[model samples]
Target: MQGRNAGIFRIWKGVTVSQLIDAFERRFYYLRLSITDVCNFRCTYCLPDGYRPQGTRNTGFLTLDEIRRVTRAFAELGTEKVRLTGGEPSLRRDFTEIIAAVRANPAIRTVAVTTNGYRLARGVAAWRDAGLTALNVSVDSLDARQFQAITGQDKFHQVMAGIDAAFEAGFDKVKVNTVLLRDVSDIHLDTFLAWIKPRPLQLRFIELMETGEGNALFRERHVSGELIRQRLEQRGWRCQPRGRTDGPALVFHHEDYRGEIGLIMPYAKDFCASCNRLRVSSMGKLHLCLFGDGGIPLRDLLESDGALEALKTRIAGGLNHKKQTHFLHQGNTGITRNLSYIGG
Candidate 1:
């Protein structure tokens, strides 16, 4: 109903709304929920100038009750993992409350949050106590100066301290997300590889993709994740099998190191074949694909607990319209203005 896929809509109506399976047979079991689109760091690849409000779209973030309703519906549809993402998810005042809401669902096993780690040192312990099961921090570079240059923040040491705090808070391992930028993260591969040698961390290098506002930067510094994969394989890292609710990253493990490596190569062949995650923006719109159009609004249906059935139906119906793959390879970034806009 959201896109120009009337034929699929007809089929969706006839099919049983049991689980989240698209026309291509990809079953979605993971949901990325964006609590807010207000980031603090100005990463060179995303939010270079920091977050800017779009038009009069302020004051539209989903309320706590709405979030609870959304999670309940998804849990009924067999969602096992719920990852809290955002421009900065911690920006929300009720972040801990939101975590408890999602963790309340018995069917939902994983309650993860991907943050910038600015508050992890001071708040990770409390967040852990509030039922947060996993943590992912974005650290583009290990060198303090290089990190500042890429993220436009001088709190590299502070962020690093936050990672230590995460371990102290009882996290088995903290996943680190680093956008692969040419001449930036590429040259410091050894530094990242070495830093993780004895640490309980999973360093994920994500390939930079073109977005509505990052075309020029994408052209200038888009590094191939495939190249990094080759380097890792050559150095004796073995690819590990992914779990049912695991993300797109191809995880690799090395016997010589305590940490693991993950590569998120979006441009790779058959990248979308194993798609199992869906996204919901802070404003309560369901995005079947990260690079999809403006998404299907579900805020109205989320207002009451009575609308749970309708919410599930609408979400299952949207799967029929999900494309087999994103058009990023064809240079089509769709309506995504930036990664922060929809919680990339």
Candidate 2:
């Protein structure tokens, strides 16, 4: 079995593949799957009001079988945690089927989903029953009008209900992912704290990145995680490093509260060194870095005779291309992918 420092090898269906290793020697155990490139709500910083999906059925996106096979391959190659992402992964017509298919691989230990929670309240039970290990709901602001303005949707109540449903459905780990806006963050934080205080969910603040056409507004609206943490500290909330962290978040809990808070500062902090991930776009393109664009297409070979062997070799080659960091340059000038297309 092929292995790397601090990494594990895998055997799926008697096919033993090497551990996932990138050029920087980082061992990868997490795979992020973009099941679809469409969402019901258009968040201002992610996908503006008029943004349309760029996924193409024939080339850009993957079919159910394609996703299943690739996930199996990745699982065999040592992917322990799998997260379903999207424009909104729930937008896929057979969303649960896809999740069930991915979760079917016994080697994949954790199955998580990131969604906007628009349709979650109604469908939360089904997903929870399908072996969903964790749920991350994107709730940017608590202000009704501000929430409506940011998401281009007036279903804030529905989203909140979904969050409640996730907790009620016995999801042990329900995380609230929020993208802080410089102008409205403090006010938003107050509402967020008040709402999250009594809940058992974890609230994670993600530093906003300028992707696609949203770059023009990045400098003005982007609020650093450091500032947010300082604001919380000043308010008598103690922040400390948690002994164990989940994903890329730097998590901490308040001594007085049951719930905790986390920070993912992609721009403000250089976190690429410890990043253990590989991304598969909804259309089947494999991305080594969020900002870089070189991808290995797997559709054609997935049906071949020696497909699994070829896939392992190709994955190793792809790891050699992983960039150390993502540069969030301003506007359409640097990172051209919008949130919807990138499935962030």
lDDT of 2 by residue, 299-329 (tens): 6766744687677667766776677777663
Q: Which pairs clash (backbone N, Cα, C closer than 3 Å) in model 1?
A: none
TM-score of each: 0.94, 0.89
The models' CA-based lDDT, in order, is 0.90, 0.77
Best by TM-score: 1
Q: Residue by residue across 30-67, what tens digits does model 1's lDDT show?
A: 99999999999998888988889866975579999999
Q: Using alpha carbons, what is the TM-score of model 1?
A: 0.94
The whole-model C-alpha lDDT of candidate 2 against the native structure comes to 0.77
Q: Model 2 Cα displacement at 130 (Å)? A: 1.5
